[model samples]
Target: MKIAFPATGTDLSCLLDGRFGRAPRFLVVDSETNSYQTIENDGNADASQGAGIQSAQAVIAAGATAVVSVHFGPKAFQVFEKAGIKTLQADIAPISDLMDKFRQGVLPRMQGPDKAGHAG
Candidate 1:
């Protein structure tokens, strides 16, 4: 399974960014190989109108089946739902620890967005 994490930095040791849409980048990890790649949020972190949508789109394009984040906004959650992507919630922690919790099935699966959409 490929999982994407909204990250504050480029590696597993880095802390979770806590905001899915505004994260600087995403760290996509391949479960089978334990290898990973970094996907820039493509300036979506600074987007005024559609950050969540664009970030979700980027994760989908990265072929991630799941996204682990502190929280998500409504529009982004809807996008992931429509794409058949699973959303997992994790507390603020290093990406590596979050992955460990995920492998242990301790991370909670989110049923809906934890946050409201950005207000224009």
Candidate 2:
């Protein structure tokens, strides 16, 4: 599966950006090939309107099947759900370390969709 992570910087050692739309860069990592690509955020402040939805759309456009981040806006979570992309709250560690944690099954799978009115 492929995953996208909103990162604070260009490297995998960077922390995950907490704000989806405002993230400096997005790391698109392919689990199968262990390759990655980075995309910069070009949208302006107006992008904050429906930021979650917009971020989710960007991730999908990057061909991500999962999202690994520190947090996700409620609306963004909904978009992930609709897209059938897995979302997980990231540990407070480097993005590369987090990826390793995921591979090791140390990170827990996110849960919420089962509840009525589930949001981030």
Candidate 3:
């Protein structure tokens, strides 16, 4: 499976960036080969710009089956889910540690709509 993470830096030690739509980096990791690639955001806001959608598209284009991050706006979360990709929201920690936990099945599988989706 391929997983993408919103990252602050290039390496796995980076913290998860909360803004899915405008995260500086999307680290695409392939679980089989353990190879990865980083996709850069084309400079856009988290909510109302094309860049966010494009970034999510790029991750899907790279064959990502899942995304890990601290948070996502409702729109972005819907995009991923609609594309049949799962989203894992959790405490932002080191990417390597997070990946290790995932590989070990220790990290909980995340579900549900974005918090921003709550129509109060």
Candidate 4:
């Protein structure tokens, strides 16, 4: 499965960024092969509005089967649900550790948006 994590930097060693829309980058990792790709999120990061929607679209385009992040806005949550992508709530941790936890099925799936829309 391909899992996506909001990140502060490009690599797995980087800390997971807590804010989904404002995250600087996204690390999309393939669990079976451990191969990954980094996607810059600068456009959405600085977006005045619709950042969550844009970010969610990016993840879908990146082919992420799941997402691990601190939060998702209501609009973004709906997008993921429609795409059949699962989401998990994770605290700030290294990307590697978060991936491990996800593979072990220890991370909790998010049922709804943790905060309101456009919350930053």
lDDT of 1: 0.91
List ranges where model 3 is wrong by over 4 Å: 45-51, 115-120
Write candidate 2's Cα lDDT for 5-85 as tens digits: 888888778887765655777898887677889987767214636655677788888999888876676677788898899
Model 3, CA-based lDDT: 0.75
Per-residue lDDT of candidate 1, residues 1-120 (tens digit): 999999888889999998899988999998878799999986998998889999999999999999999899999999999999999998899999988888898888998998988877
Residues 1-120, model 3: lDDT tens digits: 988988888987788777676787789988877778998774644435454567778888889998887766666666887898887776888888888877887665557645563221
The global C-alpha lDDT for each of the candidates, from Candidate 1 onward, is: 0.91, 0.75, 0.75, 0.91
Query: Could you tell me the lDDT of residue 57 within candidate 1?
Result: 97
Name the 10 consecutive residues with the lowest summed lDDT in model 4: 111-120
Compared with the true structure, what per-residue lDDT tens digits does model 4 show for residues 8-94? 988889999989988888999999998999989999999988898999999989999999999898988999999999989999999
Candidates, ranked, TM-score:
1, 4, 2, 3
Winner by TM-score between candidate 2 and candidate 1: 1
Clashing residue pairs, candidate 1?
A: none
Give residue 41's error in model 2 in angstroms: 1.8
User: Which candidate, 3 or 4, has the higher lDDT?
Assistant: 4
In angstroms, give how far residue 39 of model 4 lies from its true place: 0.6
| Clash numbers, per candidate | 0, 0, 0, 0
- Candidate 4's displacement at residue 74, Å, is 0.8
